[model samples]
Target: MRAIWKGAVSFGLVNVPVRLFSATENHDVQFRQVHEKDGGRIRYQRVCSIDGEEVPYSDIAKGYETSDGRMVILTDEDMKSLPSRSSKEISIEKFVPSEQIDPLLFDKSYYLEPEKSSVKPYVLLRDALEKADRMALVTVAIRTRMTLAVLRVREGVIVLQTLLWADEVRQPDFGVLDEDTHATKKELAMASSLVDSLAGDYEPDEFEDDYSEAVEALVESKIEGGEVKAPEAAPEEETEVVDLLAALQRSVDAAKAAKRGGGTKDEAEATPEKKKPAKKATKAKKKAS
Candidate 1:
């Protein structure tokens, strides 16, 4: 993976040169809108309402609307005049107990790799943090905005996880939770028993996306069953809803299966993409189907 940003981590009188790289990526399936009849992809264009004409990309400018409904267009030069922080350093403020930082504050995580010359200092800081069981609170500018982050050692590497400000976290104040709530002692005991019975080590690799797997299986079944090859056949719709008890039982079974070393290959799986083939190819594919 390529480094997204290059900077130095500053603490005390030491500055360790490091490269920042995103540590996570999304693997969710995505879909595009298309015409069902012809299988043509749909696209959107930027059109102005005033003249009902398509606007060129270069003609667009940022506009701030005032309370009085007047739009003030801001140009590139005007945006440059606005105050923004851009720094080439990740300045450490202080080290605090790792447990004090809530998981919700974390936004994104990045790995910090030290430069050849700065390896010694980087190891020094990592060792200090590990020994103290703490995380370093830091600030760094990224792209067009400043971010609050925490530096912590993970798997022999320093990981910088960006955080959200306090104001960004909404106060959970739904009235249903505020009133006096009570659970029967029997119910509580059963819940605790349930929790204890299911508790186990969190091996992230054990879990799989069953929905995506089912989707692929369904598609493969259709292809082999000649549903697509013979479009004249009625389309089959399969849907099932598992009850609460059934779901709980399946979870337990899955845990047991995991204990038996059950797992699929770790490969990026995405929803199948529907593309508009060339005219002749599309015709041939449809005719063959």
Candidate 2:
């Protein structure tokens, strides 16, 4: 696998040049949206809400919506004006007991590979961490953003796992939980016995994604049985003659009228192009069933 980042792990006066690689990947099966009747792929356009005109990707800008419903659009230059960190050093802040780090705070994990010349120092750090049973708190700038992370040993490699900010984790609050509940001595004993009866050592290999496996098998069988649909050719777009802003306003009005049960069949079908996707989706559901 290609290294996603190249940097140095810095602690005190020691600096070990290393490469970062993502430690995990997903293997989930994916499906594409298509028109059920013709098997054509469903395409979505980026239409402007105010103008009802399809906007090209190049014209798009990031917008931040305020709590008061005001939008703040930021251009590429505006974003660049914001503070960013692109440092190539993973700075070790301090060493803390492994137990102090909550598993819930852990996010994406990456494997660190040392350069040939820095192998000795890398091994020293890894061995030292393993012997102390401590995790190194670190600060690293990945993708131009600074984040807190921990360096821990897994197998023979040093793994870097990013952490969520303290405020990111929400506190649990439930009215039902506020009420006092108690279990009797006999009930507690029965629960403990039940837990003991099902207790076993965890072996990840013993488990499997049964649903995903079944889906794969079903799809393979259908393919073998010649149950695939041929995709239809998409139609070319013609020049838009309607006024974009007027069309957008009309679309909004039509939607509101439909929601209020005041729309006729003709009014519902006024914009055939906009309605085609919904019509196809309904057909797809029927076909799937």
Candidate 3:
């Protein structure tokens, strides 16, 4: 909820004062390394390899190794001399269609709230971007580092999302895909049909961290003085070599059944009944009387 950064969004002569807050948070349980036998906390030390001695923070200096095995030490002042692009302001370089940017480039998102006096300009920019269906490509400096980011309108609010540079993305090597592949017209058609049958509107709430939930359950069981029972591993069913067309057809049929409210056997069995026992009803009536 706390604002991570406070700055202004600048484009040409217009500047909107805003506070930036992170849109996401880390929810994973954290663990620390410890000695198993003594249950002692493990500690790390910065040591020099050549001298085999722990170095103090004051003694540590940044260095770069050269081809001749010589290390050139860089002082704090030397590092400060490096040209910084992201310091004072968030600069918007260009605006591009939101659809044109690849989803993979998006890293993290932050909510932007404008100052009271700056609301007009903020809404102006937000509405402009919304009308154009475009996002502003921006560069901002945070903690001495420059970041490539996108400024877009989300639900009447401006949002900034940090992006990864083009060089950071690894090229998808299609060598494996090109090896040996052949599909019949009927097979491809059936596969496409199966995909269409399974397609649904994206709902992030429907997904969950099942593995984390299981792990938490295991931890709770252990903490409650109950023996953690090893789950009986289900036997892996052997995969049948079916005709591609037939397999896709089966998948399509299953998807269609799911979409049509036809509950699976497990779902039907798991559903709780609404009927109450006569004895329980009598007991409740007696208690009320």
Best by lDDT: 2
What is the per-residue lDDT of model 1 for residues 1-289, given as tens digits with 9 covering 90 to 100? 9999999999899999999999999866666676576545566778998999988666989999999999999999999998777789999999999999999999999999999999999999999999999999999999957889999999999999999999999988899988899999999999999999999999999999887788888988988987553224434333233355676786676666555655521211211242234456779988898
Look at candidate 1 and give me any clashing residue pairs: none
Q: Point out the higher-scoring one by TM-score: 2 or 3.
A: 2
Clash pairs for candidate 3: none
**Model 1: residues with Cα > 4 Å off, grouped in runs:** 65-70, 217-289
- For model 3, the run of ten residues with the poorest summed lDDT: 266-275
lDDT for 37 (candidate 3): 57
TM per candidate comes to 0.72, 0.80, 0.71
On lDDT, the stronger of 1 and 3 is 1
lDDT of each residue in 210-270, candidate 2, tens digit only: 9899999999999999989987566775434435767788878777777777778457646
List, residue by residue over 1-289, the lDDT tens digit for candidate 3.
8988888999789998999999889988666676665545566778999999988666899999999999999999999999876566789999998898999999999999999999999888999999989999999987778989999988888889999999999999878797788899999999999999999999989999987898888889786986434344545433344456676886676667656668773443332353246558899999999
The models' CA-based lDDT, in order, is: 0.85, 0.92, 0.83
Q: Total clashing residue pairs per candidate?
A: 0, 0, 0
Q: Flag regions of model 3 displaced more than 4 Å.
A: 65-70, 178-182, 226-289
